[model samples]
Target chain A: MTTKTPEQINEDLLRPLEGTSPRYLAALTFFVLVVLAGAAAFLHQVYAGLGVTGLNRPVFWGFYITDFVFWIGLSHAGTLISAILRLSNATWRRPVTRCAEVITVFALSIGAMFPVVHLGRPWLAFWLFPYPSERGIWPNIRSPLLWDFFAINTYLLGSVTFLVLPILPDMALVRDRTTGWKKKLYHVLSLGWTGTPRQWSRLEMAMRIMAVAVIPVAVSVHSIVSWDFAMAPVPGWHSTIFAPYFVCGAIFSGIAALIIAMALLRKFLHLEDYLLRIHFENLGKLLLVMSLLWFYFVFAERLTTWYGNGSSEMAVFWPTQSGSYAPLFWAMVVCNFVIPFPILAIKKLRTIAGTVVASIGVVIGMWLERFLIIVPSLSHKYLPYSYGSYRPSFTEIIITVATFAGLAMLYMLFSKIIPIISVWELKAGEVTETATAPALARPEQVRAD
Target chain B: MASVNSIYGLFADPDAADRGVNALRHAGVAQDQIVVMSSEPHEGHAFSLLDHKTIMPWLAALGGVVGGACGFLLARYTQVAYPEPLITGGMPLVAPFPSAIVTYELTMMGAVITTVVTLLITARLLKWKQPLYDSEISYGKILVGVLGPSGAARTDLENRLRSAGAEKIKTTGQL
Candidate 1:
């Protein structure tokens, strides 16, 4: 219920884009250097062949594939959540939608790079495309990997359009307010937006359709990623529950990522008033729900696997439960469930700091979840003689770390170029709030409700 | 491009803009001649209802159909047309289920891309010539104006907008 004029909102939101601090530069430079190091490692790997990494006969899909799934799951943070919130007409979503959508685009882009990074022959990666080639062979349309190529590409395109549609007016606002090359740049970016009623109406309509259209695309993207494992007939991965489990875990981790990103933006960008306690409380409740859902999926997957007692499945199950991978398994449980469950479930403990703690745990836990799902199952495949354990080499580790840094750097640079918060959406919300119930616009009234 | 004449007035509030629209309409401005613009959508207001019923949804559906066909054919024809079709994962060469996934993704992409293109075309965005424009629209002001009104009609429209509580009135051509 913190009321702000459109002018104040614009000034506050646009302030971050106007200038750079030494801290921002230092952070960007650090991220870029880390990314460059990752690139160097990737080059080394490409030159040295896939043997430089941890891949063996059995555990070929190791850190890179795990990173791929984790990042793609993390990408569910933005477009899916934002679309749902917009469709649901969540009033608190005004300040959150843009940041959330930005995460999806960046995270998805980074996630999509892993398949290329992990390729034995990176140059031959274009074979994944559907084009007719000189070799006279088309990619197998039936492969889950091909489905992934289509799904991720579609989601990325859909997400970019989703993010760009709402940014037009904000760009126009910047175009009008600034001068020189910045103005020229924003003018081109804005595409001659005049904010005519027709334009606004059409934009709103398009957003509505996108919100509806993108949810399934997002769902299908993660599900296809899961199928990449499930279709393999590996002991633990070949399950009917893998698709929904991955999708739920995706939203779970995605929400956690969103919370952490929002917290950082609030602290660093001075969006304290805009990203309020109520927003955190609401998102914390969502995190709690997803955490429970994630736990349920894990329990259901395990309970059925353990009860069925198929020797092949148990081969993968025992190591994850009480054998070599037990520590990581229990840690994943603690991070994804035990620690977050109570913090998020308790109202008093679900403050910004509390949620951030829980979110960090979930982020780590989800990464572990992806790792456990890929590695343990591969290591314990039914053939005992072919059993192998994978440990990531320096190259894999550096590239993995680089992807995280790359996402942060992209987000940082994007914030500088575009208003992190949607200015006009806030204004629109304010107008609606003032018009519908002026009395409810009071801070005390809003708090009591 | 020739400089088309336009007269516009900026109003601080939407109600005033609505009133300005009403005044212009009362002063015999054609429905198509009147143009209203604002930074945010003012749905349910008369100003926002200008040609509001659009063919965007239909066109998007058509795009989806076209994309679906292209995707289906791309998957089926490409696999079949290959001199030696490789049956993957024990599935048929022309796998319906997998083809459906490709079709679904392409259909959504087609719809999304078409929606944006339709919005741009229907909203008349990216025009090289700036039609009636005022920077104040970005400052939470509503612009009410007439595009290509006759020289004799310019004074009448400006007077109506001014009397209807326009904070500022502007002209882009000789009046």
Candidate 2:
């Protein structure tokens, strides 16, 4: 690793925030336009009716629900990983934590929108809130969707707090270095931080508490999302394993998304010096573990379902295994397992480019996994007379595409506004590393790689 | 409130800052009177431990207990308030299992929020008036100082800091 002074680290990390190039503006404009199109499509859907989308009686939940699950799962990338890394005291997490946390905040905001968008009268979505009203009715606490409303909101708040607390000092650094209106903007954002020992110690204490607190919240958020399906009597959806299965798949896809986001930031922001190859390799190894875990869950779930062979369950399973959904199912399997397994398992193939390729496959495969879980079970009910098929409408497709563009735009804007890396944490790491380097060089600690 | 007549010293090395703290203590400055600040945490260091004890965890737990009680009451009161005929068929009012989910979420929310609030209060965040500060602290320097000392004490403190290898000594605000 190349050693950089504190000044160099600050300059390199803050460079992206200093200036906006034409290419960046163009990319921003393009993303904005795509997102606008998505909003327009949603508006049209609202102006029309549920008929505008490819949704029906038996197939009530379609692309919107699938997108909801997929984005929520993707949100597992940041806070969970960062919290776990911090708890485990992984030193390399310094550069990667902020970017990962940013993803959690942004992806979650986007994911939370789908439930609103799916509503026939989204304007009345506030009814989901459990506040007292003139009618004296409350949101059903027994319902998983209500649980979702509370869980997702709590997670979002916790995530934003987790992301913001550490930013105060970095913002103070910007406040000190810059002048004019930029100084004033950072002044407020920095919350008048003077870096007193009490302040630093308190901040550290708060972070410790949040790190311990957020893990269970994250796990429960996905578990609650899973319970949305599991609580129902639907054949494939009603299973005890759904919670763990969803949580594992969530972390799996989350790591993949984090890898993709890091690659982009490393490329665009010129962070090659900071976001080193070792970070990617370490994350790639994690992805490999999650891949194996994901496969195990899928295999176990399928084996049980197949062995049980209840007529209603097989009715839903056969279509996914050999019928109309077979192609998509096989594609999901290949993307989630076959492609990533080899690329990640072999050390030689686990380079930056190789992990990115595997991550892309995992992202797609995870989306398909969500879609297959929702659609096939809903479409193939136990009663043959009530059986139906579903496909996404142009509106659903446009909105789904828009969500990705929207997330990218938020991420780009966030990178420009805030230093994407934690400057103080890096410096702190250097101090500890310098202190510990000689001890680590002792013969017993040296590894023969 | 920021103290007036503050004397500050900037040191490029934490060890020098540590010496400054020791010198201040030796020169009759109380441990509470010496203020130290740095860009990063120096855990287990003397300056980090000075005046650093906190009650944030206990307070956050109280917040969680309060929030959980509110969640339980909200769920139960609202359920019982439902008109007798409007009750969902056969299902009992105020099911413990479902209500526990809301309780858990709100408990976490309350704890997280209270923790942040406690940090702000204890750290004195957003206080526009700050004690003797140096922007160079952000550039990998440690700051050690005595806030609002007497005129005679200020000179002695400055001398101690200079002797302790302070790169720059600064006095700010009214004496």
Candidate 3:
């Protein structure tokens, strides 16, 4: 049997579709329009300040902050899956790793911006950074808000590095295959990769090390984000279980985002053979697990608060269970826990379509969960005298829409530059004995089983 | 100068590159000279014969220490310099718990940043220079580059590589 060289394999893998299709152009146009609308809304928010939001004395943290946490949570899915799977040597992870890593980068970028947007004055946001200025006073180190600045920045840097490192060889492939502008782009990005054994060894070692190191940081980043609420002295806000609760919620939302992304890429890029039903099935199982964990945490936190019968806590709990926010609360429960647990439990319901529905539900549910966490506690403060209702203004709604649009636009732009799938890893896995061994068996022998 | 003769290189399926590396060593190639390269970083068991060392751990640890120190200094110095500090619930000037949060965040930040920077530096990235690379390597090929002396010996080495499933063998400028 003749073995193919690396160059031959790359040509076979990438030479299929070299030019832009009509569908791609249409998608790009739509993405550009959404982004412009978002930019306009963002500019309005800048002009109006925090007055444009639904925030007040009590309910200061609203949709922008919640969405910030939500996006950060979504970012975790990519890094967690890529890093953990890479370390474990899970061959199935190859087709999805690049997309997963890219999700982390884009989500982090979008998520990190929310804290800045949430600030009353967007211009003074640099105060969070430790820069000596004319003013003698520094930002409070004791505040969890400051902790978020450091945690998020670190997570973002780590994720970008993780995403870029593995794509070097693939970029080299693109460099060789294209000409003119695309060729120049890939050539600059490829960084002189010769696939020399020494370079490969160092690259592999670095990635392995990063895969192991990044997991805890990803967990910590979100946990610190959770602390922004938990550290507050407010009745419903201060809870011990908030860290794990937020982490599970984050993972649940993250997996949903991953499913959505995977589905889109599979459709657009024609990656049916690589990203198969088995991949979706595994992801469905993960979503189910996160759903149950979220339910358990939510239940446990509520049960303790209800049993304690603290008047202050009861005020917050009543709104969530049977008061103004009750509908959103119940909807969150059904979407996050009830719908997912039953539907995802069955193997047949774990199909791509079923998983997509469950994923969408979980995304909506997770959003409500964040709202429930932020709003009720603010609406039912300890003093009760200061507590007031929050009605999100048009500016807040438009800005929120813009953030979502911006996220989609970033992802759309990324797909154009990098192959959504890690071409090298996918091809590498394809050429392996383990990858090829299944084909070597006789059909009769395999059918006998 | 005594000229070296034959050089043999072994190539394997991307999945079994590590195993092939082991087998090649068992077949008598020196650990120092044999090189195994692949698209993904499989576990090191595949390259046990070769020295596998990395500077990331050291860099990460150093970053953690520096970050921790900076965090402590930031908290401690701020408290010392501010004559009239805002007291929350009559708490101590230097609360250990809050300070711990600062330390933990900075430590993690340092470690992660160092790991990322070290990876880029060690990988020799962003140089933007082009090199001779077969694009098929991205399509799941494991390449083992080996060097040996001229003529008949090189031919024998080529035969070994061919038998071991090495494809498209070509010599580099005299090494």
Candidate 4:
């Protein structure tokens, strides 16, 4: 990657928004079709009832719950990790933070939809809130479901703030450079930022406070998500280790998703200079650590369950170990640990291609892990007569596929509106070390927008 | 807010901007009267007034306290205050563990929401017009605007800016 002047950087970053291409329109059309298909499937499920899903008595929860967990875990990719890196003074985070922060906001929004989608009466989802109505009742505050409701919404709000606050200056820059409707929209989004000292000061302070404050909220979110299963009395579901295990898995999957998003943005947006090989190398190392930690967690969990030797637990466990779920079980292991461990553990193979491949595997593997955690236990319960199998119906399958498409669509649209790579931050990074250099002194070289 | 006559200087050099700030101070411009506008945050620069003190920490704390209290009360009152208690598995109505979970989440919500609100107000955002704004700052120029300058002081400040390598000086929003 080569160093770029602020002018070149501005031109490169803004190039995506200069005009829409036929290819972009085609891609957007494809994603919109998928979203519409998912909406249609959801309508079918709603009209026909939850019976339209593959949900059965023993295996009541299936793909939707897994997707909820998966999307929620993916949300961890951005804001939490970016916040941590920012607070730790990780300078390399500059190019990556905006991309990651955007993921958090979108993924959280997508993830929060599952609970509603899975509900028998999606319209009554508001009952989850603490609002007292004519029925004169509040939501059960003791339930972990309510806890998740509060946690996810709070996280969504904070993530949006975290994502939008730093982008204000960039938006103002865009506002100054653009014309017509887009310029008008930028005016509102930029919040009248003029790069004044006090504005930047308070913005930085607010970001700091949010950065410090959002960590525990992020941590608690996944933990509470874990508690959704852990609080249950079912054999495999009830575990004290669920909180940390789920949190680790979330961050693990989150980093993988971020790497994938970065790679995609790099290729499509022509940000080769900005999103450099060094970024992939560093994030690959982080992903490698997370992979090891994830392996430790899985090993510890299985070992404890095996040693405890409770019949109910073993009944839930054996299928995952050597029974029906063994294939998905091992596939998950390969995708998450076996494949990624070697690829990421070695430096030469940790190239952009290598990391992307590992990330793809991790994404698939994490989805499987969520599925395996939810379904198998629910399937092979202690009561042998009640033991049942699940295969997702067309409705569930279509909607699940659509949600993935929805995410892709949302991300693509977002990049078109705002530069996927933050322009100002990248420019700042260039001048940070050489602020007094003659190159900076001659700001007249900067192109007039 | 008291209306003050604004004198603006545009510089290409960060060092020039720094020196220009000093000259303004020498010319009797108060620290609060001077504003530095740039495309990037200059956190440690002497001219970077953005490193000024903020009350975000205290506000976050206050918000957390209030939010946590609400969380606790919401949990307690919802479970115990109803005409009929909603209990699970014969457990106590107002379980401390369950209550603490919601308390922790809502407390964080309070802190973040408070921090965001404080940020908006203190940053003086959403205003129709901002003081001393110029499109040139977006094009990599650094702006130093001193408010409340008189005829002679303004000219002296402009001359000081000229010596410090300002590309141009203007009072009517020209960069």
Among all candidates shown, the one with the greatest DockQ: 1
Residue-wise C-alpha lDDT for candidate 2, range B1-175, written one tens digit per residue: 3446788899887767777877777776655567888888766566666657999999989888888888788777777776763456456788787889999998998899899999999999988657567778878788998876778787788999999889999887766
Pitting candidate 2 against candidate 4, the one with the higher lDDT is 2
Candidate 2, which segments miss by more than 4 Å at Cα?
A433-449, B1-3
Q: For each candidate, what's the DockQ?
A: 0.45, 0.44, 0.30, 0.44
Q: List the residue pairs that clash in candidate 2.
A: none
The deviation in Å at residue B125 for candidate 4 is 1.0
List, residue by residue over B13-79, the lDDT tens digit for candidate 1: 7777877877777776667788888898876566666667888888888998988888898888878
Instruction: Show model 3 residue runs off by greater than 4 Å.
Output: A1-17, A431-449, B1-51, B78-89, B121-175
Give the TM-scores of the predictions, in the order they appear.
0.96, 0.96, 0.85, 0.95
Q: What is residue A443's positional error in candidate 4, in angstroms?
A: 30
The models' CA-based lDDT, in order, is 0.89, 0.89, 0.74, 0.87
For model 4, the stretches where C-alpha displacement exceeds 4 angstroms are A434-449, B1-5, B173-175
Better of 1 and 4 by DockQ: 1
- Which runs in model 1 stand beyond 4 Å of their true positions? A433-449
Of the two candidates 1 and 3, the one with more favorable lDDT, higher being better, is: 1
Worst 10-residue lDDT window for candidate 3 chain B reads B1-10
Native-structure RMSD, model 3? 7.2
* DockQ, prediction 2: 0.44
TM-score of chain A of 2: 0.96
Q: Over the stretch A398-427, how does candidate 4's per-residue lDDT look in tens digits? A: 999998899899999999888888777777
